[model samples]
Target: MGKHVVCKVSELPPGERKIVTLERRSIGIFNIENSYYALKNVCPHYKAPLCKGVVTGMTLPSKPKEFNWGREGEILRCPWHGWEFDIKTGKSIFDPHKCFVKSYEVTVEEESESVETFEVTVELGAVVVHI
Candidate 1:
């Protein structure tokens, strides 16, 4: 496994995502509530560019005639098939146990730490994806 820097922390604000190619693998790096998460860009079903889909919330379980929405900016909606996935876990909403996208561990590295580790000068912090 290796760490690949995706972008500066400032580049991807809260509720934003950036798709990058690291080690010839296309991965989607997301910033949800100040935390970073990485998912494979390819959709598990049809090989669509999953990162290009919309980021949205899910409808929570509620009593009849009531609607509850939660996990805003944490659900990824597939552009082609309308399949929803949890951005944090890359799991499908319908079949979480069997169907899911590939996910990677993400981290935010301080400029000083990156300078020493990667020998690169950064202004603030960098988003890193481990693969």
Candidate 2:
């Protein structure tokens, strides 16, 4: 696995995401509810930077055909057309079978002794895309 130091854990704030370019690939690193996740920054629909989108809990209709909605967990919504995706799995809630975003492997290292010691590494997993 290729491990790249994208940013320090302290650089990211909870419920926020940032775009980082590595090897010509745009990467989105997010800190949600104290956990970290990384994905391709570009929206698959139109290549818009997903990092520019808002991060919020997944919204689902209350019933099969109801207008009411409910919250699911950390999801990223594309600002361009409101395409929603589960940040944890990179899956589109609208289309479970065919939509997804490229996800990266993230490692958070916290010190057992010190409360402030921490490190984070972002890596591309088995799915490799050349920029």
Candidate 3:
């Protein structure tokens, strides 16, 4: 386990993600409005580049084959095939524990910032993602 600095909080806003190479692995760091979540980029199904896939929402089961759309942009779809996984847990919606990708712990920290104009420097805390 190691700490890999991904990006500043301002760099990755909600509905956005960044792929970073750490410890010989490709990890996808996602910003989900209020928090950050990281997942292994490889799809366990067929070794597809999972993070490169589309980020979408989750649908809820309704009455008797009916469905409802919800949790927009909280889901991820594999690029090679249509495999849905929750971004927060890297779990397959159908079988969460059995079929899922690897999830990584993410931490946000404060960083000092330097202003360019007027040579002004301020200790502006930037959001940091650690995996």
Instruction: Show the colliding residue pairs in model 3.
Output: none
* Candidate 1 per-residue lDDT over residues 21-80, each given as its tens digit: 988899999999899999999888899999899999989999999999999999998888
Q: What lDDT score goes with residue 97 in model 3?
A: 72
> What's the TM-score of every candidate structure?
0.84, 0.71, 0.81
Residue-pair clashes per prediction, in order, are 0, 0, 0
Which of the predicted structures, 2 or 3, would earn the higher lDDT when compared with the native?
Answer: 3
What's the CA error at residue 120 for candidate 1, in Å? 20
What lDDT score goes with residue 32 in model 2?
Answer: 80
* Candidate 3 worst ten-residue window by lDDT: 115-124
Computed on alpha carbons, the lDDT of every model, listed in order, comes to 0.89, 0.77, 0.88
Question: How close to the true structure is residue 99 of candidate 3, measured as C-alpha lDDT?
Answer: 98
Give the candidate order by descending lDDT. Answer: 1, 3, 2
Winner by lDDT: 1
